[model samples]
Target chain A: MKLAYYPGCVSRSTGKEMDVSTRIVCAALGIALQELEDWNCCGATHVPSELVSVGLAARNLAQTDLPIMTSCSICYSNLRSAALTMEDPQVRAKVNAVLTKKYSGAQIRHALDVILEVLEKNDELITVPLKDLKVAPYYGCLLTRPRGGIDQPEFPTILEKLIKTLAAEPLDFRLKTFCCGGPIFMPQEQAAEDIAFLILKEAKKAGAEVIVTVCPLCHLMLDAKQKALEQRYGEKIGIPVLYVTQLVGIALGLNPDELGLEMNAVSPMPVVEKVYEKMAEEA
Target chain B: MAADEEFKQEVLRLAGPEVLTCIQCGTCSASCPTAHLMKPSIRRLVKHCLEGKKEEALRNETIWLCTSCQLCTVRCPRGIRPKAVVTALKELAEREKIKGKDQAYEELFQRQIKDYGRIAEILLSGEFMFVFPQGALQSMELGLEMAPKGKIKLAVEKIRGRDEVRRIMEELGKG
Candidate 1:
């Protein structure tokens, strides 16, 4: 019922819309999200050293004992890896040394895992099913990769299952667990663009009307960078990248405005309108 | 010469012995989405680390280019963590003052967090523009687009627990 929610930096700032939708969906599903008190950024891709990065993660972990739920893939990956690293006696000592609060063991759960569990338990929560919406579940690398990830790394289908539960079609995209060029977005802008272009191109080619993602960075790459990518390749890639929460919220019959659909750089309204049209026709 | 040896030991110490298990299988390189952008590739970086060529590995753009996606880590047959190896090299580069382009952004990131405890996107871009003027012109298109969308914040709002975060970071400095 209740979990410590760690929205991380992007979710608070650039990815605030995703966070908004996450809250709305969770409330609708009866999952109480208690924001971690005094939580800091999870040292995304910018920390100077492993020790400092892990220490920052540990500091956040030390704040709460409840299973930490993170929406950002970078935060999930970093927090999980830090918790795993603290298993080492040396790492534990080093991490413990650098903190006012010491982290012994913290279970990091991706927010998707939390929602998936809720959906599995109760399938009737889907009041407004997206029967005709075809969505590609883009996991990106961090959500389901690394050691002790939530699902199978190479071929994750948990999001696909969730999509099906919402009565939407989930495409078997080849790059489901692919990297979104998030880490290099700032420094190597062009490289990041090229990678984003490839992901958007592939998702479009796969007949994905909407590419749903859980990670803010991945969403930024696929959605916010679509215009730049289109200009670079001299082609149209109008596919809308959506947060999983936003899609789930739509299926749950929540208001589109509350879901932060407007916050998306490429408006998801076209896909949303199509879904609405299909639902009305069925009615 | 001894300094180079010292850097090698530091890398091994931070990254651990698992990095030494790399068999040059190229699974990491092949799996890496961004390996094409780098010269030596992640596999070669590990090889360089194993050979104790600390300077070469640290100086390579590959170290900074890693996105920490862990795709290579997941695909590596030998259970080696190529991402951690890159992190170690990045730390080594920071220590040795080799100064990769990524390091500049990393420094800016750290400074922003230390000062405000949270990143104010608008301020961050403004500061980034001042620091990397060439990039400012290039990224301006993206920045201009994000401003009206409510994605970029115009003001810096410090987190509620700045003192606590400062204390934790101070402890790290003492290390």
Candidate 2:
């Protein structure tokens, strides 16, 4: 299967691991990701709030002929929201008019939807089972909110299914869709820190050694901000925040470094080392 | 009496008539994650907005602390969208130029949209470091340590859409 991949901005930079691991895992699954040529930013949370129609149109133009695949949660939401909005005739007319003026005809699909479709089609690719891995799947806000398609706005089942496919138990946590305070980081740093702290705290309480996420923004806010959150909250959140793709790569027996696992603020080595020990014991 | 009336009118304008519908059920405040940090309850803030007590609602930092996840909106039995109410209050505050510490973050976001046309990592990290002084050193250390290890890219290629993004921002009147 072929997918037009959109790594978004964060994945191109700080969240490169998400891009790396996603490519590795997809390759293992025999999925070809043809990156969309000269793709632009998705306008994220800001554009949608300000100019909904234009934002949707701009995103639609970036998509190629094939279905779109993204690693960023915010990017996923923005793309999904745009696609959902364009489905409405009135919205489609208005957005299409704008898009036609800017660029030529275009269409888009949410990365999560694409990922799920790929997994469904090639369920057998998850050959190496991820045994005894307790993953607390964190959805954050974008993937699940503001009324969209694919998953329920508040509660999503996609990540849970993906985790289960890899043979891991998905732990239930109250703050699954809770904001990692990604948007608030600049305007309300302390508030953002507190929010992240609370989410990590909840994940820890829920018995998750690793928090798997689909969004690069959530990954950045949770993984990158751990030290600051711990310093402010006076508690260490030892759980490693990982991109779901990275876990899939690990399960597929890909090299850890190739997945860019070391770039994470919270080192995933402890978890990986433990998993390896268990695998060795079983062997 | 006139001042009290004006206050009530302002709150009513901001929160809408539904603010009066609040039964002080404490549902919003109870469910709020940052409730412990708030001095007055979010319920009270909504009540104040409903009563045109705009000053009290805008003065409280709790309004900014809201994650806007709409959890309270779901929890409200009377269909009071406290998050929206808080947002309305925030808009009022912004129009009034009631600057909060985090206002710079808004500027930073604007800068991203206006100048780069995209959210660049180096720029965001620079902004983050500027806002949090400790981040500056940490980021520097990270740059020095991670660059050689290939964990950090010294110069990442900026998308050509930077100018296009700028034009888009200008068209939106945000640039």
> Highest TM-score: which candidate?
1
Question: What's the DockQ for every one of the candidates?
Answer: 0.61, 0.26
Clashes of each: 0, 8
> How well does each candidate reproduce the native contacts, as fnat?
0.61, 0.21
- The C-alpha stretches of model 2 lying farther than 4 A from their native spots are A46-49, A52-57, A60-63, A84-113, A231-236, A273-283, B1-32, B35-63, B68-98, B128-158, B161-164
lDDT of each: 0.81, 0.68
* N/CA/C clash count, model 1: 0
Error of 2 at A166 (Å): 1.0
Clashing pairs in 2: A73-A215, B7-B52, B8-B51, B8-B52, B10-B52, B11-B49, B11-B52, B12-B52
> If you assessed candidate 1 against the hidden native complex, which CAPRI class would it receive?
medium
* Cα displacement (Å) at residue A7, model 1: 1.7
| Candidate 1 lDDT for residue B163 | 72
Output the worst ten-in-a-row residue range by lDDT, candidate 1 chain B: B1-10
